[model samples]
Target: MSVFNSSRLAGKTVLITGASAGIGAATAVLFARAGSNIVLAARRVDTLKAVAEHCTAAHKQSGVQAGGKFAVVQLDVADKKQVAGLFDQIPAELKDIDILVNNAGFVLGVEKIGDIAESDVEAMFAVNVLGLISVTQLLVRHFKAKNSGHVINLGSVAGREPYANGGIYCATKHAVKSFTGSLIRELVNTKIRVSEVQPGMVETEFSIVRFRGDKSAADKVYEGLQPLVAEDVAEEIVWVASRPPHVNIAEVFVMPVNQASAGISYREPKV
Candidate 1:
């Protein structure tokens, strides 16, 4: 087996959305360690700065040279005006992004169908579907001009299998899956590549956000199972990006061993 060489990522610039924390932040650090310049975009500028610092520290630890610069941008992808002006906000040096990680997304509540809140539905779709599309549209245009780029979207198991109490979120991910498929078909003849990484049972602030800051409730989501962590998914993302240009890793469905589906996980009983 040929050993994967991460050096290929050196000097490449990557733009990541929702990069304030979780998988986005982890991906930034990993890419930085690989000597890639990173543009971290999120609404929380302070948190983005912290992530940038972590990226710098990771690059230093890796001993890589001549790369690993970072820029933090305040972005709320849900806002169309902000998404439209994103590139202008990026540093000129990092404007030519080699990779776009569409990671800015979230879930609001777990209300079942008949009782689902309209506001929650709109909020989830705004960021997860529409916001993702807006960013990708802008980036794909740039990619076409350069004739090269990679769009890596953060999808979820819910995209493949819908679970009760997560209808809207699942629908949004399904839209993402569909959008990724369409993009792959559209870019088949181009050097530009499109990929989706669907992760399952990740133990992140995701659950806390889903539970609206109810830490105790969020904790229960992973009560007795070793769920995947941000690093796990981030490693997969970096690995996907490290592949040779001729190779396209179209889609990756990653889940913890204990997770079989969106709602089906083998969590051990409390002792």
Candidate 2:
């Protein structure tokens, strides 16, 4: 086994949403390497399959002759019916999962409140807010019955501070924070742990999606300076998960060295 994994997460089942790309995909790889069986769910079947394969490959690369199992489910967490159906189809290996990474979320257009489309606002709330809650609510019952599990919600710095033209997105993230917070209290005195990993300006498909497929605009968001990559945030997720049973890492605020907050970064001009 890789020294990184050390079988620390051996035999655990981890479920990751938004596992088709970005931090979700990266986290699946890291956790699999750590000896966790992974269940990857995303809206894109083709992309989710690739990520699931990558998870098993990571275990092989870690020198484990028998790699951990990887499962994939095409899921749209924003759709409650789909979420329920997706859970029903989980393989035995993924049942009573030890961890739930609520990473299936998105940011819609970055326009002023007035200019933002109602669809954008609704979609953001549907996925980023209610979607997270739906998944967590379902899992909460499961965890309570088992009296064990961990929940890691993917929040953002925007959740703590809103930016111009990002009000709707920020509001969605803010709701995430609130939901996770309440979860902590509800799960208090239980073996279940609740945590949030709020990232700052990670350069992922998030930017491209936010810009409506404008690659050049997405590129500019990270031009002239380093931004947190999905892998960087993935490492943090693994680290937090690997903590001792007694240690519940309630929150982790991670960012590049150049970033002090959301939309507040020190970037040098290109020559």
Candidate 3:
């Protein structure tokens, strides 16, 4: 028997930030397969459209008669004007979003505190913290009006346990953790569900971006280790979204078997 209650997700609308790649794109596809309409938002409209096509294909393959529609929106969450006017850009049919996945986040570098560039810190916080808060605020208002919705944040193990050379990234995720916790408390009396999925060492473009396109450095980070992939984390996000109404998956920490913490991992010995 399947564990997911597909009925719960059918016909639901999900808005995913950073849907152009990584966990965001995977989540969009998974939700589409479950018969959910998706709004794919990211800076890369071309990539977003490709993801949308995949979503459509997934939904069709699922043989679901209803839902699974997609909207690809060019969004730079760091842009306040874009975030403020996001709904206007979305199609009217997808405006009533049932789920908001705050997954648009990135890390620029691995520089330590003293050596970190000012621009890097600003960029990290702008997208990871402020951008997430902005999008959530907009959706929160809508959810409050309807008294129904789910907010799933993409956090990181860095949020729980900080490590060297990841100060800014860790700080941003820590803010995400605090924000999610506060949101849960604020919505305790309401039907709105707030959850956070904190992943550790997911092998995605995240490391590449952190190292500024140095593939070798990024590869070394996961060398001799089987890191969690984007699909693994996406599954967790969808599972939390598919739970029964009364069951709120407050927080989930997902890491590979070899990963014990943000900085601790068991890598295979070099031949």
Per-model TM-score, in order, reads 0.98, 0.96, 0.99
lDDT of 2 by residue, 48-166 (tens): 89888888788987765433888888889999998777668788767768899999888877788789889899999999998898888888888899999899999999998888989
User: Can you tell me which runs of candidate 3 are displaced by over 4 Å?
Assistant: 1-3
Better-scoring candidate (lDDT), 1 or 3: 3
Q: Can you list the residue pairs that collide in candidate 1?
A: none
For every candidate in turn, the CA RMSD to the true structure comes to 1.5, 1.6, 0.8
On a 0 to 1 TM-score scale, where does candidate 1 land against the true structure?
A: 0.98
Candidate 2 achieves a global lDDT of: 0.87
Clash totals in order: 0, 0, 0
Which candidate number would show the highest lDDT if scored against the true structure? 3
Please provide, for model 3 over 1-271, each residue's C-alpha lDDT reduced to its tens digit, 9 standing for 90 to 100. 4346667899999999999999999999999988999999999999999999999999999888778789999999999999999999999999999999999999988788899889999999999999999999999999999999999999999999999989999999999999999999999999999999999989989999999999999999999889999999999999999999999999999999999988789999998
Worst 10 residues of 2 by lDDT: 1-10
Q: Which has the higher TM-score value, candidate number 1 or candidate number 2?
A: 1
By TM-score, the best candidate is 3
Model 1 Cα shift for residue 154 (angstroms): 0.7
